[model samples]
Structure formats: structure tokens, C-alpha cells
Target: MRNKSIKKLNNKMNSKKVIVTFLILVCTIFNIGAQNITPDSKVLYKKVNGDSLYLHLFKPEISKKPTAAIVFFFGGGWVGGNPKQFYQQSKYFASRGILAISAEYRVKNTHGTSPFECVEDGKSAIRWVRENAKELNIDPNKIVASGGSAGGHVALTTALIKGLENVDENLSVSSVPNAVVAYNPVSDTTLKGYGSKKVVGRETEISPTDQVKKDMPPMLIFHGTKDKTVPFENAERFTRLMKEAGNDCELVAVDNMGHGFFNGDFFRKGTGNKYFNLTAYKTDVFLEKLCYLKEKPTLAENIKQVSCIGDSNTEATYPKFLQEKLGENYQVKNFGKGGATLIEGTNHPYFKKKEYKNSLKFTPDIVLIMFGTNDANVKWCLDKTRKTKFIGTPQEEFKSQYIKLINTYKRKNENAEIYVLTPLPIYEHAKSRDPEIKKRIKHLYDWVIPIIREIAEEQNVKLIDVNKLMKKAYKYTVDGIHLNQKGYKILAKKIAKEIK
Candidate 1:
């Protein structure tokens, strides 16, 4: 009896320990994911037949007038994919002062709806947004619809096809959007093009391009030359037809790129963009065109467009000073965000946010790059957690991606000249992160400086060792992290001297 009692007590103790350990793990996970919760978004629904259709509407943050809205549809080949895939893009648009609505329609698997029914529902969503524009603080006249793949098909079809009398009468409004931005879309549904397979009788109705006519709103089409699913020529043909109809149209061909080019290169890196062959692709130049479509400058226009491309230092350090030095020419177009490596820029976040814009409006005649800092940091994790593939060891991958970035810029802009600046030295001041961080910085310089020399020798591109030059102007820097106005003046002058 005594031995049995002791065994039960020990078992109880182990159970308690297990519970405590599980609690600790749960707390740790919660801590890692503890971001500020965004306010609950407003959800609105419309009853269709006996069921209900839902739309997630994110109103503009600050606007005097009803903002231009987008009834966004997510891509799933008409059978699958979820509406939640648009969370980031929707929030981004809403944060940028645009009203965004991510709409949900019956999917083929879920509702057994035909492709035609999906298109009809897409049209109905646009009509709903327009009908309730005033109530939703949206501009009916300026509503724009956008999507990718099948979603792109929906956006383009709605904009290109004029009269959809079958659209829900209860909504009671025109389905036409003022603008359509289709990302790697099925421009010709007839499936008779370079990349399309015959799907006329099998899946979808006849090609929407066949139904094209005049009065379609301005269309912006983006496609990858290497896209096997959707032909690049389809985009070209659609743009041609729209132009022939006297409607405004523009197509941005992403060189060495492929299908679903939207987030593949722009949203996140290593998100299956390896097939894109983006080693020399200029994606941002195209995106900026969409943003500044009405305000695009002519080729002869000499606008002071400066690009500050680098890692964290570019974002946290040089931009504000560069802005002051150039006065008006400084647009603070820094391509680097935090923890971003060179590969990320060439393939993703930077390409989407910065480079896509440059493709459309103005290629930077002058680019200032200061990136080796992160590349050299040995403690840095080369592989992103979500992206299991190793981007590469610091030396091999960093050097290759940087070379690719320069080559890409050259390919995009014939007159483009990149001024590669070595990263600044780590400051002597630090509490805990000083010694190891500084050591890594030195390691980066060892790898990067020699590579820069080799690059200068091989290519016509210019290299500036800001580390050595800044030593002469050390007093101009703030915390040795960034440049003050005096430092920027000196840095710009040094760059100008190098260029001259």
C-alpha cells in the first residue's frame, strides 16, 4: 500500500510538470505572434436566392470625398482559392487611402456554379459597390476592379464586355469599372493563343477578347514573357484591340518573368518565384506606371528621380538627408526595408514596391546602392523561416544577387548607371549587439569590397567605397548609423565627383 501511494504521487507530479511545460510553450508562441490587432473590419452581405454572398469592405482611412474603390477577387482557377488571400493587398490599399473591397462569389466546387455564373457574380459585386457607393464612401465614377489569373479574367471580362443585362437587377447599377488592372490574365478565353489551351466548350465560354468593343475603360495589363499558362501575346493582342477601339491601354511585359507575376515577384521572396527568371526583370517600373498613370512624364522629361537602394541603412539612415540635399530631386525612393537581403530586392518586396513603378514612369538614370552591411552579417539567417530553401551562403548568394540586380537595372534602362556604395562601418557604441554586429560588418566588407572591385573591373558600372570616404566626413553622420544634412551634402558631392 505504501509503495502504491508513492507511485501515484509521482505520477501526479509528472502530470503537473507536463501541464506547466505546455503552458510555457503556448505563451512563447503567443509572444512571437503578438502583433497589434487591427480593428474588426466592417462586413456586408447581399442575399442571392435563398443564400447570401459576402463582401469585406475596408473604407478609406482619411478622405473628404468617396474614394475610388476596387472590388477585388482572389485567384483560384474558378474552382478553389480563398478570399482571405487578399488580406495584405486589401489592407495595403486601404492604408494608402483607397477604399478596398474583397468580394466573395460562388466557387465551382462549393456552389457548382459555371464559369459564366462566376463572371456574372463578379459583375454583380461591382454593381453592388457602385449602387451603394455613397453609403460606402466610394466614388461610383472612379471604381476600379482588379485581380489575377481567373480573377483577372473576371476583372477584364467585366470591363471589356459591355452589356450584362443578366446582372442582378436588385443591385441596379452599371458593372463597368473605370479602370482594370489584370495581372497575368487570360486575355483571350478562346484558348487559341500562344499559351492558352483550347477550353471553349470544355470549361469557360468563348474568349472575352472576341466580345471586345469600344468604350471599355482604360486597361492596364501585366504579363511575364516566360508565362506558360497565359501567353504574353494575349496581353499584346488585348492591348491592340482596346487601342483599336479607341480605348486607352498599356501592357507591361515582365522580361524573364512568368504567369501569376503579381505577388510572385512583388509580395514576398522565395514564394515560388524561382521559375520567373527574374534575374534581369524590372517589375517596379510597371507598377509605378499604374500609380502615376495620369501624371506620367514623357521620355524627354527630365524629372529629378533618384533611387536610394540599400538595406536597413538606406531606410533608417540616408533617405531624409538625401531628400534635403537634392531639395526637390530627392523623392526618398528607398528600395530597402528592414532585414531585406539583396535576393529579396531582385526577386520580391523591393521589386514589387519600387521597381514596378520605375518600369512605367521614369527609369532612374542614377541609382545609389549601399547594401553589403546585411550581406556580411554572419549571424544573419540566410534562409527565411517560411521559405525553407537557402537563399545561399552569405558570400556566394549575396554576390550573385547583387550582380543580378545591377544587370537587371541595366537591362531595364539603357541609360541607367548604378553607383554601388559599400556599407558604412558599425558604430563603436552599443549595449549588447555591438561587438558581434561590428565583427559581422567587417566580415561583410571583406567579401563585398573585393567583389565590388571585380564588378568594376568586369562591368562599366561605378563603385564608391563610402566606408573610406565617410571616414573623412565622420562628423557629418548621426550615431554612425545615418548621415546628417552635412553628411548627405558631402556624400552627394562625392557621388557627383565619382560620376563626373
Candidate 2:
């Protein structure tokens, strides 16, 4: 009886071992799959004082070519911050078919450096990605610069500020990003803003607000209205200035929230996750607008190409904001030049320029024509010496040139849809800068605009009244002549609505 019991116990032990081994195999397979979905790789992007700054990359299981990328910087007031702060974001973007990276920069805690060094390292990280784009399967033009708080300032400076690049790095490789996503960024580092004292006399050089220009990339900023650290007014002011410079900037305001409200991992629990998720969702929407995501939030498919042609207002104007409003499916190109006119004998004729040829080459599905603003110039239009050279009056010549240009496009592509846009209204304040321009403005309002409308009717093409829209948002105009970023956005919305 004793021998039988001992054999039975050994059998039970053997059964338990088999079950344990099977469970271990299942868990191992699960873990492996998870790792394959989001795998981490590290590479040294910069080194300073014997310390190696590494970029922690998170790559997704891509089925096809992965062309989009996002590089994130962590925020800690430029004093101390860890790359882990953006680990969750990196993984999230990687899963969405983006090559996500969490970059390490010289911080006060580790490198004993200030904000200037941090900015330098940020630029280096972008250059590294752009330089190695082909090898990493990333689109150099589609790379996005994103960060939170002080790190947000670095990202903005990388795209805006001209100098302060790393001396040891490759200067040929540009560090500027195509777009920016900032969270509660210290964008205005002026005397009234945070980090001003830290940057010292270089405040204006480092401040993204102070560095605003006409051609900076589209930016999306998230800020809390109640936040005291960075203050909500800073974001408002920065975006205002950006628009004033004719650049696209979108601000998402979180009501009654404070600083550091966007960290998803920190707010993983409870209602805090709601705020984090909201920001992420909005970010996805913004990226989708830029055509960075493969699957958009909306159901539109089969992208359409759009070409915008005209003067300075058309150069970096509403097409950019239009691109954002139309989402990824509609590709918008700007073929505008400053001081370009429809009349051939003018100083800068639109038809004679290379942009016209390029626009024809694009063979776009939709064409937006916004001329007449510069054509109405007194020196170019009503000049006594040049006026008689044309077949008729300046207004009559404008109509004829516009009709010929329209016919040229229609003949080239019968299927192409052309939309004529009325020139934006010029404010008196802008006209005051040049007396001749002010006189020209009267001619535009009285003669040029009516003829444009008449031509649209005669050609049987769609007409967009941009002047009416700009009149409503006249406050967004910086110099009375050109629409600021906000005005462009408003105009773009009107154009986009017509297109849809």
C-alpha cells in the first residue's frame, strides 16, 4: 500500500509540471507579439562632455513603406526632464504608422547646461532624422517637431530661429521641421513670459514669438486657460503674432486646467485620462489634416490635387490653411508671387512667371485664381506711359487677360474645375503706408472687383467672394493689404466650404 501511494504522488507532480510549462509558453508568445507591435531602439544623436545623448526610437510593425515621423522632447522647465515622459506618446504614434522618437537633450540635471544648450541639442536631433531619412524609411519633408512646455519652446525655435545650431553637426542638413505640435509651450520668452530671465539677453533670439516670419510651418498649440506656470495669454499672443505674419497656427484651449495637464501617463487614472485622450484625439485630427496619417478620422478617400495661383496674398496664403481644413485627401499647392499682375507689360506678370508654367505642369483637379490685387496698382495699371500700350483701359485689359488665362487652363484640361476668387479687401490702415497704393485701392474696389465678378459670370465658373469674408475679419489684417494668418484661416474656411 505504501509503494502505491508514492507512485500516485509522483504522477500528480508530473501533471502539474506539464500545465506550468504550457502556461509559460502561452505567456511568452503573448509577450513576443506585444514586443513586435512596438519595439524600442536607441541611437546616439549627440554627445557633449563625455555624455552621449540618445534618441529612443519606437518602431511599429509596418506592413508597407513608413514615411511619416514625429520627434518629441520632454518638458521640465529646461532644468530637468526625462525622455520617458513621452514614451507613451511615442508608442501611440508608432502604432499609428509613424516612426516615433523620444530624444535626449542636455538638461540641467545631467549636463549642467542651460536652455541654450537644450535648444542646440533639439536642432541636432531633427538634423539627425532628416539626414538619415532614407535609411530609416522616413519622409524628410513630413517630419513633425513636437514637445511640451520648455521642450515645446525648443521645438518651435528649431523651426523659427535661424542660428544657434550645433557647430560640430552637419550644417548642410537642415533642422527645420515641416510642422510643429506644442503643449503649453513657453513660446513668448519675453520679459513678461517664463524663461525670459533664464535666456538673459538672448530673449528675443530664443523667443519663438519674436522670431515670427511669413513662411514658418503650420503649428498646433494646446494650452490650459487656467494654467499659471506658462499662462494662457502666452499661447494666445504667440498664435496671434504667427497669424499676423501669415503663418498657420491653431490653438486648443483647455478651460480651468493648469500646467502639465497633457501628460497622458501621469493622468492615466480617473478623469484625468479624459483630458489626455482629448488632446491625443485632437492631435490625430490635426495630423490627419496634414495628410500624415494613413487612416483619417473621416471617411473621405481618393485624394484630389488643388493648385492656387495669384499674387503675394496667394503665395503662402489661404492654401496652407485650406490644406488643413480639407484634410489629407486634398493636396494644395501655392503658385503665388508678390507683386505679380495679370497684364503682360507689368513689372511682374503672372503669366510670364515660372509659377504659371509650374501650375500648368501640376495638372491639378481644381484651380483657384486670386489675382487683381497687384494688377490694380496705379503705377502698373493707370500709368499714363503704359496705359495706352494695351488694347483698352486697364480694367478692360484685366478682364481680357483673365479670360485668356482661364481659357488657357480650360483648354489644357477640360475636366479641371476653376474657381475665381475676388481679391481681399484692403484696409485703410494698410493703404496709408503708400499714398499710391491707397489710390490704387480705390480703383480696385470701384473697377477691378466688379470686372472680376463679371468675368466669373461670363466664364460660367464658380466665384468665391474673399473680399466679403476679409471685410468681416479685418482685424486679422496686419498691413491692410495682406491677410494675417487668422484672416487666411477665415478665408480658407470659406474657400473650403465652397469646394466641399
Candidate 3:
């Protein structure tokens, strides 16, 4: 069950990245094609370690560069794992204006005297980043190492362990990271750790927390409540020891979550797990604390205040955008119901049926609407041909039902502005939908735009032409329908621009 939850979290995180990145990459490619480049850029830096170890670096293109850097190591039990495990880490940090490097280390199978080789590689990557801090426009003093599972062990060890004499022959640089951010790291090198004896040779010398020093860097650890693989108590014990030794350390145990909570089901495909993706939430907290940035996020405080209303697009839209844009100003309420249409009345199957009840209660200053996407689908009866038989026709009835929903908002808060957004284009070759369906989605602009315009005119509210905005930022969409990071960013900017 724990594994299932972690897998779910991994998938959840992956789904977010795939959607966001596709949108951003699409826009980036189009921009580059047009000699227009975005502020975000990534480059692959290869360092020779007998063979080349590829390090993927994500950085903003802005002139005043990052004040910190995060070097991430991946986990696959030390024998088989890739750098991509930190996909969300790289993107999350980069989105926050931190230079994030996802470093690939030599796995045990192909290259290494022991897991220590992985540590050496991790250390070298950190040193390389610091050595090139000036060129990379990073602050060397702010470099940190972060990872999960075996990767976490590597991060913690590289930070706490004093010498790398075994792998020193392979590198000419320091093996220390300024700070350590470990997610469920193996602090004790006993038989209890997954394959600990095989890697570290049954020695107490390998335990990281057991060797704390006054010079030890500040550390943050995130673990899950039900994490059986690396028991939550292990992390607690490690944190306790760190504090006992007068070293700076903190531990967060996510409620009802399990090991590898950084990712949700999106990463693991269809693994049927429900882990909370604690990494996604905790990572933001980690970085905020690391930089000593004043706007520290408190989950207990924010969860109660923020709500969101969206569709699948909401996953990419409100949560991904508004959370970052507004920061801590307004609590986000997510009402984004996937595959929901306005016309279904109280019995509407998806989120609409449940969300419509509280719509009046929230009485938010600004109500964001991105309802047209799923409504454009044949399933929701918004398709130009063959609308869902139960939901009525696509264009007119759909528009009327949406208007009625909006009117309720006006009744509740006369001063609140309803932002109407047009649906983004669909992918040209989506397997889920038939060719006709795909074509209908691609032509969403033809039908939905006019209806949205009419609604905006009649209501006297703002209309964010996301479809038009997204058209200019095309590369971010996978098949011209689902958005990637670039697309979400464009939409986010449009929404943020209208607000203040």
C-alpha cells in the first residue's frame, strides 16, 4: 500500500511535469523558431568520470542569476536509477529562480567500487557547480544536495561524511555540499536499510547522522507517516541526533503518506497508489527555508484558505499558476472539476455537481473560469458533432447553463469580476479521441470563442483570451490541446495580468 501510494505520488508529479513541460517546450520551440526566447532555459553539462556523466541544469535566462543552487541525485536502489527521478525537483526549483542540476551518477552495475562511487560522483557534481558558480551566475555558499531513497542516502552521506579517499583518484575537487535536503534518507547503515549491507560493507562508519560535526550544514528531511521502507522513526531519530549534536536539522512526516511521496500516480503511470506527493509540497517549504525567504509556506495555514476550481486544465492552470503568482495573498480554492459541464444541473457527474453548492459560500473577490475545455469534448456534448446525449447540445445550451452559473456569482457578490477563459486547442493525434473528436477539439476556437465573447459582453466582466494567448505560445501543448509548462506560464501571465 505504501509503495502504491508513493507510485501514485510519483505519477501525480510526473503528470504535472509532462503537462507543464510539453506546454513550455512547445512555446519555447516556436519562440526559438521565431527568434524569440523565453526567460527559462536548460543546458546539459557533461563531466568526464572515466565515461561522461550527464548533468542536466535548469536555469532562468534572466540576467541577475540565482542566489542558490540545488544538485539532485536520483534513486533506483543504487543499482539502477536515472537522473530524471528529480524531474519535478529540477522544474520546481528552476521555476522558483533557483539553478537546479539533476546529476546522473554511475550505477553499481556498470561503474563503481561501491555505493561510495555514487557519493563521489554526487560530490563532484556539486563541486563543479560551485567552481563554475560565476559562469552559472550562482552563489557557491548556497549550493545544496537533495534526493530520495538511495539518492537521499547519497545526499546525506556526501554532506556529513568527511573523506572520499576511495573515489578521490577519480576527481580533483571537493565532495561537500553546503546544505543537505534529504527525503527519507538512510541515516543508519545497518541491515535495516534497503541493501545497506551490500553497499557500505556492514560497517558503522557509513552511518551519516552518527558522525555529526559543528561544521555540518543545515539539513531538512521529509518522510511519510506510513513509510515502511525507511521507517518514519528513522528520520525522527536522525533529526533528534542532529539536534542533540547541536547541528541544524528538521524533519517533516507527511500525514497518511508513504515512502517516495515526492511523486504521485502520474510518475508510476497506472500503479493505483494514493500517496500525497509530499515532495511537491515539502520541496517548496524546503527552498523557502533554505533561502531564508520571508514568505515561508505553512501547510496548516494555507490548506484552509486556498481553494481551486478547474478541470484537467485546472491541474495546469490554477494550482500551477495562481499559487506561484499570488504567493500568499489569497487562499486558493480549486473548483476545477475535470470532465464537468455547466448544464448538468445539480446531478452533473463530475466536480460541478459537488462544487456548485459552495460557489456562493466562498464569495471570492475573483472567480476564475476555465470550463470550456472538457465541455468542447464529445463526452461533455460540446463537440461540434455528436455531443453527449445526456448533457444536451454543445454550444447554445452549454453557454446558457454557464451563464446561469455566473449569474449566481453576481447574486452573491455584485462587485466580484468573473474571468471567462476560452479553451485551449486539443492535440492533433490524441489516441483517446477519434479523428473526428480530435479535429473538433482542434477547432474549439470556432465555436467556443463566440459564445465566450457573448457571455463576456452580456456580463460586463473580463475575458481572458487564453486560446489566443496559447496560440502565440504553441510549443507548450502536446497535441495542441493539453498544455505544457510554457503554455501554462503564458496562461498564468494572462490571468495574473488581469488581477492586479
Candidate 4:
């Protein structure tokens, strides 16, 4: 009888010890003051391997409805990297009405963890987001995963390679994201690939390229052909396999760009990272295509901002002339990008450039839009002809995008005056620098110019005919497409007089 009593006493004491230990661990691992934590912060999200993982969030300024979300992981070959790698990205996506998060994971240098732990943490972060979606005001089904290099591999793995999830995480909620966007990811961790060394024995298990399956979510990849670190071929191989498995994957091969090409350059140099801004814009396009965003962006703060929007011609020469004439009080700034077509979905859409966003941010009293030069380039688009770099056609995309761009400015300032300019006549000749421009000069006048006129008439806005003004001034063209300084001066003088 005494022995039975002792056994019961021992069992009860052991149960109490276990409960006390569990309580101590809970106290150490979980943030007791979680309510005091910021809305999107270094949240002690995942508890594993006796460590806590954090993720920072950038939520929409006004969350009127449940919104889509994107989570970013930073890359450092599993040795290092932090959440801040995508800080600018998160902020940009947030401004566009999506919940953006930059997640922290176990890295080799910091956590003495393997790639397996990284994957586990990555999965946990996604699971956490879904688990708390109602409170975060996020639509659980519209989550997207994106990252650069190794971080990209982690994001990709969340969709492709599975089963490395943390045991404590809720498995009922999917770790898989609805869409994936990778920037020069170390996607293939096979023995033949660069990242294979990091995972060592478990390369095949974590390799996204090896795990391609049907019914996978849509994916967008921007990999530089010149990327020597991960080899542009890795992304191509993964994309090829993904397609073969009947998955929707779009690979944007960036020519002559190296690894980490999407990183913002502000910290390195004072100038904004054009590459970062462009990629972020492209991501926005991708999400919009999926109908995932809560709403389109609108309005901003400003001064006596005069935003000059256009293609390469407007980039430096003519905008400089306009700026010089306007003087300091007008604050005329050129937000033009080379090879920019106003049509959306093209490789070089004006909407994809940082200049476009900056122009809107300028909150100008007067807006000058000088496009149609690139839009008229015959080889660019002809209803999915597969010959051009642009994804939009002049007929379907030009007029609508023009109206949208105009409305975007008006939203910023209802009183803002906008003027549309017709492109100069293409002078194809021996001196023309661009062969395509010379060869396809006919399209500009035949179709693009007439369309610009139609939009100017229908939209009931001010029209400035730079082309008709210089129809006989072909000799002033530096290229068949772009104008020389003398031609720009004529344009500037004309614009200055009209606006005045």
C-alpha cells in the first residue's frame, strides 16, 4: 500500500515539474507584452531551437477591407541577412494597398542553423501571417512570397519544397503562398548549382528546381543573365521545369545585370535605386493582374511641382529646357525614363519606372506628358506578334493607360493642369543612330500620332503638337526617334510659350 502511494506521489511530482518547465519555456519564448508591440514590428513570431524569430510589417495606411499580403525574406547564402533587405520593398508595396512583411529567419552565422531551419522559419512566418490574418486585415488566400538570392530560395521553397515546417506551427493552415516573386534566387541547390554547398547533404530536399509540381501558384522571376553567383541558367532551369509541370511561371531575364541587381542603391549612393523601384512596380503589375490588391493608389502631398513625364527624348534635353525656362519657383523636374512606353505591361512601361512614381509624388500644378514615340515603334507591339519587347499594343493599351495616367495626376490635385504632346516626326536616314527607329518610322505618323490626336480630342485636355511644329526640322534629330539639343530648344520654347 505504501509503495503504491509513493508511485502516485512520484508521478504527480513529475507532472508538476513538466508543467513548470513548460511554463518557463513559454515565458522565455513568447512575448508576454505582445499587445505593447508595434503593429508591424520585430515580433517574436516563431519559437524554435530555443530562439525567437521576428518579422517587420508594412501595412496599408487605410485598411478599409481585407487586403492581400506579401512576405519578403533576405538572402545571404544562409550565412547572414536580415529583414531590412526588403524594407524599401515593403514600404512601396504598402503604399500600393497591400500588407507587406519582411520576415526574419535563422541564418548560419547568427543562429548556427542549417538551411533546413531557414525553411522551417520561413514556413512558420507564412503560417503566422495566415493565423493572424483576421486581425491584420489581410486576405488569407492572397499571400505572396518574394525574396532575393538565398532569401528568394527560401520564399520559393515555401511553395515548392514542403514538409520542413516547424512542428509547433499549425499545419492545417497552408504554408504555401498564392504567388511567388524571386529576384536572382539561388533556386537550384543541386550538386550542379551554386547553393548546393550550403545545404550539403540535403540539397535535393530543399532545391526548388527539383520540386516543381503541377498546380503550383503563379511565379515571376527577374534574373540577370550576367549573374555569375547563382548563374542565370538556374532560374531558367527552374522555370522550364515549372512550365513542364503545367505551372504558370514568367521569367524576366535581365540582360547584363548581375546578382542582387534588384537591391536599392540609396544606402550605397545618395541616388534612389532605379532597379528596385522598377522591380517593385513590376510586382505591382503582377499583383494587379491577379486582382489581388484591395484598391489602386491615389493622391499625395506637394508644392509648386511641375512633373515632366515622357520617354528618353523628354528625359534630359527637352525637360532641361522646360526647367530652365520655368526657373526655381515652378520647380519643374523631369521624371522621364529611357525606352519608356506609356503602355502598361511592356518591358519598359513608363508605369514601371521610378520616375513615374516620383512624378506623381511631385504633386505638380502643371503636368507635361510626352509619350507616343515608343508607343508608335512598329516592332514593339502588334497584338501579341512576339517580335517586340513591349507586352501592350498601341490600339488596346495606349488610350486607356493615357487616361489612367491623367486621372492619377488629377487625383493628386484636382486643380492640376495637364498637357499632352505629340511626338516629333521620325527622320530615318544614314545619320540615325537606332536602326529600328529608322526602319519603323512610318508607324509613328500612320498610327501613333493619330491616336494621340484622338486621345487629346476625346479627353478634352490641352494638346501641344511638337511633331507638327518640327515636321520640316528632320535635320535636328540626333536619332530617328530622339531629338538633338537644337530641336529640344525649339520644343522647350514652344512649350514655355503655350503654358505661359
- Per-model TM-score versus the true fold: 0.54, 0.52, 0.52, 0.54
lDDT of 4 by residue, 1-500 (tens): 12343343323322311122333222221101111223243455776768877678666655557889999999899889867778767766765668888999999898898888888888888888887776666899999999999899888989987698767666898899999999999888887677677677877898888888899999999999999899888889999999999999999887667888777532222222445545765777788899886444221111245678898888868877775665433446678888888765466888878888877655567888888877766556553554334344556577778888888998876878888988877876677655676435677777777787888888777898988877877777665666778888888888988887
| lDDT string, candidate 3, 419-493, tens digits | 787776565644344446664665366676788888889888778777766665555666555667767767776
lDDT, residue 277, model 1:
18
Number of backbone-clashing residue pairs for each candidate, in the order shown: 14, 1, 51, 1
Candidate 2 lDDT by residue in tens digits, 18-67: 12232322222111112222326676677778988888887644434646
- 3 or 4: which has the higher lDDT? 4
Order of models, best lDDT first: 2, 4, 3, 1
Which numbered prediction scores highest in lDDT against the true structure?
A: 2
| Residue 202 miss distance in model 3 (angstroms) | 4.1
User: Worst lDDT window (10 residues) for model 3?
Assistant: 26-35
Cα deviation of 95, candidate 2, in Å: 0.9
Deviation in Å, model 3, residue 99 alpha carbon: 0.3
Backbone clashes in candidate 2 total 1
Residue 81 C-alpha lDDT in model 4: 87
Superposed by TM-score, candidate 3 places the C-alpha of residue 370 at a distance from the truth, in angstroms, of 22
What overall lDDT, based on C-alpha atoms, would model 2 receive against the true structure? Answer: 0.77
Q: Candidate 1 — which residues are off by over 4 angstroms?
A: 1-40, 47-53, 61-68, 80-98, 108-114, 139-142, 160-172, 193-206, 214-218, 224-226, 243-257, 262-266, 269-455, 472-500
